[model samples]
Target: MKQTTMNRTQRTVCTVLAAAALAAGLSACAPLIVGGAVVGGVMAVDRRTAGTQIEDEGIELRAANRIRETFGDRVHVNVTSYNRQALLTGEVPNAQERQAVEQLVSQVENVRSVVNDLTITTFSSTLSQRSNDTFITGKVRASLVDAQDISANSFKVVTERNVVYLMGRVSQREANRATEIARGVSGVSKVVRVFEIVSEEELRRIAPQPAPVTTDDTKPSGG
Candidate 1:
């Protein structure tokens, strides 16, 4: 009984750790729990192709680094990339700074387009406000996951202040459903759809198919 209890405790600890890791966006560990695919599992479910997903991540990181080097705390910005299109949110001290930031982001490699949503404001958001925004993003994501008709993995949720920005490659139905779900979430002031709209036929063509399960029937009979 003691051994069984110890095993149960160890399993619970590992489960908690895995959940924390996933919440922190360390999705490479997904294969351990969801079968063997590494990051490929996530890519498979995402609306974007694996190459596009990788490129988007690279685009966001490079753009962010450039913004930091160029502005150096003169502006507050959050960069989100989906399907190689960049969305710039948060605040800037002035209009000139906002324009400059948009141009700077546009120059980042492989960024197909830029959506400048930077507010020209005198003050940046406080840490508490930013924390609240993060909480709102998580809540929106959870709500989407709970939604029956939507494939939550298809949408990327980013929150700034009280606004929720959604990015995805989805059909009109999927996009509308996702937007409605996001808007209905508590504390979400607005929903901005930055989706790469695809037709249902195109979405079906690009969607990843489930891997086939195989069974080994050649095992020798045991005595």
Candidate 2:
């Protein structure tokens, strides 16, 4: 019994440590671009194809640049694109600016649709508030990782003003499980699921295939 208890304790400690390490790495909440591919460790598990991933990144970059050039410091907006679906978050000064922001993002090339979650506030979120949002996002991500039943990398988490937006190409079961996990996180006030629900068979169909092994018998002879 003592040995069993000790093993249980050790497992708990390892789980905690692993979750912490993953959270620290993901706390940045920004995807890295390497050789035009999304390289945040999610590429392999992400349901989106390589081409779709690149298009999503392009959509995000182009939309953000357009917003900055048009609105300057007058608006504070965050653009997160996944599977060509762009989600707009943060604060805008007024109704007109809010509508304009959505319109501008819609015009970006290759954007399939836009989900505008911008708040019409007089001032943008303070740095401290944004930091808190990032922390909440990390916590939610860690919780998802700890769940163990779902692939955490399949979801893209974005938080603004305590609201968490989850985006991914997932089945309904995965989406529901992810949403529940996100909502359980302490700092998350709301969980918004922006998922493209696909069938389980469809998910398997789109899954990446392994390269065929080359055997000595199959080796090509030099001419």
Candidate 3:
């Protein structure tokens, strides 16, 4: 009875920890504690290292908080970070506001570069338009996943007002393929590639190597 109770307690603790990790966006722990299929699917499919993924999340959150505090609702901006590079999308009231947002994002820790895709316009997008952009982004991601040649995990897709922004560390061929796939998605007005291009050889080097196979010799020879 004591053993059974101990086992049940352990299981409950593990369940709680896994839930906490998922809620906190601790991708590294999610795969191990929870089933990989449930909480860590994105982390597993992502090409970025676990550390880089966490850093990217941090950069986005920090930049977003700063922007909101500075501009309130006067400017609408969406920030995405991949491999320490930031992409700023959406509408700003003027060129000065656009440049200011970019400068602020660049100052964020761990943000190595910034792609200022902010359009200088009079007003921000409506809720319905933002919803459409979300749908478009989901479609692009699904298309990339379905493409045989492209690794969906290698690309991060973002959409604002029908414009799709693709960010990743990928080879030229992969980048082109992803762009074509995103462009083909319905309702995507434009496809912008913010890729850090790497050569085939470099990709090979960075890719995880397969473990060596070992054969068991204990089986008796056939008669």
Candidate 4:
């Protein structure tokens, strides 16, 4: 009977020891999993922030201007961010309405800036330029995408009167490269850079691409 009791105690102790070892192993792995989750969350937030930073501010200013032009000083206009860039679409009632919207947006903080592209046409049509505006936007966006030197996701582009407005957080080098690319596009007559550099990634992405080389066979001999 004593021998039986000893074996039972030994089994219980071994079970407890095994459980403790398993717990320790899990404890060690928990941090790595947790660390990965934290890093992923941060990256997602940054991308969201970058995406909305210019666009929200842009949409807000555009909405405010539309309201002010449509409702006059009756409505209060406020702008809350910069990652957003605004393109004034549709028709304004008069010249006063156009200027009023511009002035209001100018005063709004975090407004990368405003483009008063509103046409002073008759409201008879109520034509939505959203699609047209989107087409121009896609053009500039594709141009930016083709050139790998800039973080295409980091920019908010708006086009007005063939002028391209670039808004985002980027290094000076990135901003310059962006300007150059926009200027080179066929429809772009001018480019406005409204940018702020926030990190080193901006600097790294803006380095120019190496030029292509040609062999002697491909090039004519110099006279």
At residue 10, candidate 2 shows an lDDT of 87
TM-score of each: 0.83, 0.81, 0.76, 0.47
lDDT of 3 by residue, 16-106 (tens): 4433443333445455421112344343245567788789989999999999999999899999999999999989999899999999999
Error of 2 at 219 (Å): 16
* lDDT by residue for model 4 (16-71), tens: 44333322322543322111123212211123343454466466756666566666
lDDT score, candidate 3: 0.79
In order, what lDDT does every prediction score? 0.81, 0.83, 0.79, 0.55
lDDT tens digits, residue span 1-223, model 2: 9999999898777556545544553346644433223355433366787788789889999999999999999999999999999999999989999999999999999999999999999889999999999889878876776677887767788999999999998999999999989888898889898999999999889766654777798778998
Q: Which stretches of candidate 2 lie over 4 Å from their true place?
A: 1-44, 210-223
* lDDT (C-alpha) at residue 68 in model 4: 62
Candidate with the larger TM-score of 1 and 3: 1
Winner by TM-score between candidate 3 and candidate 2: 2
For residues 1-223, could you state the per-residue lDDT of candidate 1 as single tens digits? Answer: 9999999788766545433443455455454322123353343257676688789889989999999999998999989998889999999999999999999999999999999999989889999999998888877876776666877767788889999999888999999999998999899999999998999999778777766899889987897
Please give the clash total of every predicted structure, in order: 0, 0, 0, 8
Off by more than 4 A, model 1: 1-23, 27-44, 221-223
Deviation of model 3 at 37, angstroms: 11
* Candidate 4: clashing pairs of residues: 53-83, 53-84, 54-83, 54-84, 54-85, 55-83, 55-84, 58-85
Clash pairs, model 2 backbone: none
Any idea what lDDT model 4 has?
Answer: 0.55
